[model samples]
Target: MERRGTRAAVRTATGTVRRPERTATDEDWPAACREAVLGGAGLLAALTALDGAAGSLDPLRGGLWAALAVTLFALLLPPRVTAGQGWLSARGPLRRRTVRTDRLVSVRWSEGIAQRLVLRDDTGRRLVLDPRVLLANPALWHLFATGARTAQASGALLCGATALRQLTERAEERTARTLLAGSGRA
Candidate 1:
């Protein structure tokens, strides 16, 4: 009987563990994309300059020009993601989109070469993002988690909680693995 009671307490404690809300600032940038853009820009700039100094439009010049064009576009068009109390917004060179996390009714994982988070809110406003953006930032994750929890608690979240929960689990697992590896215990 005592062992059963202990197990129940442990279950209750772990079952109700809630992820805190998160917030994002304007300066937050996706680390992976930034690295690619910066590295590409530097390498392309060097190649383009070298091609120009060689005094001929050679094959390398054409390739460098094309690569430089792509790099510049990526550098200038990086997406800016910001998360607030109940919302997450993404702004790029072309457009800005916002998602009301509190109003989310469905969350879908579009997995492929790159994984995407597809969220549809109650008001039909949709936002697609790379989950790494949220998982990479704790404050942003907290805001999203709190909003989702509110929706789930209020019965406003009709579906997709499973997806959210799975993401949260993945984040936790990754954190655990990272810690263990760092400590040489993995």
Candidate 2:
């Protein structure tokens, strides 16, 4: 379906039209990362505060210390998760990638420490994008996965396998260039 800039157009082989409801944006990446870092920091701060407040000489001091620790951690930690157009971008301690809906070939759900989204190109090379930093929102993650599947099924709006492969190759080349540049070799 063809719409204005607000929606993605999907065309069938017979020239039928469909409009996709969701699109991805770039902001989702850093937000997810910040959330993860803050959460970890909060936990550490809480534990530290508890230890500091606990008195070696007083028995009641242990409970008091624990309460103080929890309070401080809650005050210091902030939630970070944002939704974007066409894609769910997330950044955490070890994750950094923009998952383009058009480039996604498959989505898999698992009961693990993190949720995994597998993207593939024409050559069958795959990139595993995991947004594990935000373990608080399983629903949102599921929504993103479902959206990816929907986008993949819509033939008109999906990227061709060959095009995806070229994109992957280009990305690798760019990474190499970046590394070389940093090393004073580019």
Candidate 3:
């Protein structure tokens, strides 16, 4: 069999990139769950103390407690990426959202020392996600462009349309090459 290049080609003719699946490790689940539980307990305790000491606490005591609670909630809610039924969903502690493969607008790597996947929605919102946070084999950058493209096409949240358009144009040449190759093979 012929050896394929390290850089996989994304074209209509070639199959879409299949990201490796991952299962949460025993440690992963428990650690995240424990953090969430601890954070909740801490927030509850702080809020109760603030309420009891309202007269003595700072004027901004309520706001401070609220902020702390929000922060704790976010930390406790683990973010997860799930792939099934022809769609990829990013489930975060605060919210859960999904995008189909066809809705993807574009995916690309952000230019940085610690590279990340910069995904754009149709309305031009950009989400810079770290691969380390996700449970997938492909580098996080690889998923950004594809996921954006898929999300866009599927009418998912249009968060960064402007950024997506700019990035797509910049990578047009490379994308064209892949498309052409795939077309030829097909």
Instruction: Give a tens-digit lDDT track for model 1, residues 1-186.
Output: 001111222234557744443356434465546776677776777766777788776877778677776767566555777777788788876788887888788888766788999887788988888888777666677777777777778777887878888998977887788789999999
lDDT of 3 at 171: 60
TM of each candidate vs. truth: 0.66, 0.31, 0.39
Q: Give the residue spans of candidate 1 off by over 4 A.
A: 1-22, 25-40, 43-47, 57-72, 75-78, 178-186
Q: Can you give the lDDT of residue 87 in candidate 1?
A: 86
Q: Model 2: what TM-score?
A: 0.31
lDDT of 3 by residue, 1-186 (tens): 112245544445566665444222222444666778788778867786868666655548766776777787776666555444334456676676654433544455555677575544344444445434432222322444465565666676345566566655646655566678889952
- Tell me the TM-score of model 3: 0.39
Better of 1 and 2 by lDDT: 1
What tens digits encode model 2's per-residue C-alpha lDDT throughout 91-111?
433444445554465544343
Give the best candidate by TM-score: 1
Candidate 3 error regions (>4 Å): 1-30, 43-67, 111-115, 120-128, 135-186
- Residue 68, model 1, lDDT: 73
Top-down lDDT ranking: 1, 3, 2
Query: Which residue ranges in model 2 land beyond 4 Å of their true spot?
Result: 1-81, 93-95, 112-150, 154-186
Instruction: Please report how far candidate 2 places residue 6 from its true position, in Å.
Output: 15
